[model samples]
Target: MRIDYVINKVAQTHRGQSEGDVAQAIHDQLRAVGVVPNGRQIAQYANAISALPQLPPNATKR
Candidate 1:
């Protein structure tokens, strides 16, 4: 699964929830869908994705 996609989806759907909450939710969903990632793994992935910078559409590339 795409980590970024999952992160964005969880963020959009779980607004107001804590980062850990959102990460756990994604972990649970993945488990239900037959992809098993441990809680720690999920948290690490979530943290990395959260740290990514958000750029606007008007931003120019170097």
Candidate 2:
């Protein structure tokens, strides 16, 4: 699970929202995405992000 990809996904889903809003949206999405697939969403999200230095990217960004 890529945090940057997740964050980008959340941002696109939540277009026009501020960065903080985007962050919250990502958190919620993470929880939603985690509960049913590989494992607990929150736990997976937490562990995935806990070691990260920052959020992911938007390949188009220069």
Q: How many steric overlaps does candidate 2 have?
A: 2
Best by lDDT: 1
57: Cα error in model 1, Å = 20
Worst 10 residues of 1 by lDDT: 49-58
Model 1 lDDT, full chain set: 0.65
lDDT by residue (tens digit), candidate 1, 1-62:
55556656765566454567667788977766677677787877667545555434455656
State the C-alpha lDDT per candidate.
0.65, 0.53
Model 2, range 3-25, lDDT digits (tens) per residue?
56775575445545454454456
Per-residue lDDT for 15 in model 2? 49
TM-scores of all models?
Answer: 0.49, 0.38
